[model samples]
Target: MKKVLFCLLALGFLGGCSTKEEPKDVTYDWAPPFEEVRWSMGEDAVFETLDLDEEDATLNVNPEKQRVFSFASAMETEVGMVAPDFIFEPGFGLVGVNLHYIPMEKEAAETLAKLEAAYGKSDDGTWSGTKFGELNLSDEQVAAFKKEADIDKDEPVVTIALNQDAQAVKYQECVFEGKNAAILEQVLAK
Candidate 1:
């Protein structure tokens, strides 16, 4: 059931495709992942930025090579704090980082608007982020998705994005743990 939710939240938000408007040269005060890390840095730089050591991270079984550093509560970003799995492609070094973060309302809203301005909207009405603006969610879904404490309050958010070779990211589910145990098994390092 949680896997269903995770799969739904992660893979399901991508609605049918359609033609896109020419993107504008928009910028946001926020950034994807981290400015310090950005998107594509060499493995050495990534490991250094995250201060990762073999003792600190375990490699994933993925053919391309992935390392999970379970901060569950350490890293901070403009949007929110996140625990991340830094994925290093054999040659690409740091191509992607699978981040699990609870969204910060004001920041998410602000960035979402910026992304919409730049990429315009999908046929389905979702906006596009430098990644996918698929963080789109109905209020009800957001209500249901938040942790119990967040219900009715709107104090947090959960977002998930997974893609290979650092393409556009699609995400916006707000919880992990028992609810997402199945995917976590595959994504989380030992």
Candidate 2:
């Protein structure tokens, strides 16, 4: 009877002194913001954001065309050293940028496949499928990529396209917000 009582008391004590803990607070809406050289940002702001070899970077101004261009072997990407051109206009400020020139030696399709595995393929090309930063993201089962890189709704989101003929990925960026793209189109047209 004493042994039975001791066992019962021990069981009761063990039950009372439970090791189970309260559930941890889970974060749901955690997404990173991708803000850089934004729309309408001036030349100084553009330079401030870029990590360039300032000694090599050259600024060319055409008074007749009212066009300004800054370019250099500014970035040594995973592929190779690339000269990214930053295009600006007087009133339009920092208008556009031609960046991320992947060397032809690196197969663009192979490069794209790796990105697609992590981010998923978009209608246009391989995209970071966070629903354009709109939906619930998986935070990636394989990797930590839950959503697309974050940017303001009004900011320009750069996209890459596979240039099969060239065997390269093209970095096309228009540094304009909303209907400003159309405005740029009109300017280019002129």
Candidate 3:
């Protein structure tokens, strides 16, 4: 009787340990906003400028004639404000654009994969992902992440992080369409 009782107790404890609950799926409906402009050169030609604030740069393309122009600058004051870079390809009608700002290379790659899974393919080849949440972080996690990442307090970190990340990702997606589509890939990734 003692042996049977001990075995049952052990089995109960093991079963309880194995029954960890899965994480809940989180959803967000907010999106980031970007600016677009139109430019004209010397002649009768008119060009459109996709001013992506995420990367602090602009892409000028003449879709009718199939011409491309790029301009880039470094970010100075604000966190998301960085100069942009442009690459020109004559034949391809704005194939893609991508901007990444994650400190770790591995994190950046993981972010990209999450984005690809969510949106199919980034329109402009740009994407961003940040991790911030209500869950209390260990001292080590906070210290390690803070050394290179911009972790804000007061506001929900996950929301802010996702917004920043969305800007870059949407910029790439909007490269061809000239319209920004903000999607939170991080929540899904987690």
Candidate 4:
């Protein structure tokens, strides 16, 4: 009886120890001040509200290189902070938020954790700073999807991108789209 009881206790203890806690749903309180102008064609508010100096914000609407407009800025969020280069379509709203934050170890780790939890593991079962080369998650797209799916604000769908280099341990880009899975899939294809 003593041997049986000890074995049972040990099994129970091991089971409990091995169990992994479910990742909590992610919530976002921070969004670009001019998010509403997204997807709006010919909206000057996109540049007007950026509050960035003329030189800092670069507008290169060249179709050859697929460049529209790119600007560098820091975005603060509940999880942490990210400094990304904002890319947008000339007339339409934002299309990409490219970030390179490897020097800031703590902030990068926190950002990675937040993305992993919110995304609930990548389809391929891989985890790296820049897992996907370039990711796109548009805020307008996500919001529309959530609304269509009947998912409320309480249960959010956060979107972020990761880029990994074979030889480099540091992550080059971490893009966070407000709330869109379809857009993410579309941009990740290439």
Question: What Cα-based lDDT does every candidate model obtain?
Answer: 0.40, 0.42, 0.35, 0.46
Candidate 3 local lDDT, 1-190, one digit each (tens): 9999999999999988995445554432222221331111111121233323333334455565433333344332122333233323332222222232444446445545554564345554443323245434445444544554354643332221222343354322222221111112222232
TM-score rank, highest first?
4, 2, 1, 3
Model 2: lDDT to the true structure: 0.42
C-alpha TM-score for every candidate: 0.38, 0.40, 0.22, 0.42
Candidate 1 ranges with C-alpha deviation above 4 Å: 1-31, 52-54, 63-71, 102-190
In model 4, how large is the Cα lDDT of residue 56? Answer: 65
Clashes in candidate 1: how many?
Answer: 5
Q: Give the TM-score of candidate 3.
A: 0.22
The residue pairs that clash in candidate 1, if any, are 102-157, 103-157, 129-133, 158-173, 158-174
lDDT of 2 by residue, 120-172 (tens): 56455523212223422233311222121234433333333333345224442
Query: Ten-residue segment with the worst summed lDDT in candidate 4?
Result: 127-136
Q: Where is the poorest 10-residue window by lDDT in model 3?
A: 37-46
Q: Write the per-residue lDDT of candidate 4 for residues 1-190, one digit (tens) a residue.
A: 9999999999999998985543323223223324443322232555565454546656675563333444556555333455545555432245445555555556555656755674456643233222121223345444434443454434333345565443556554665443233233333232
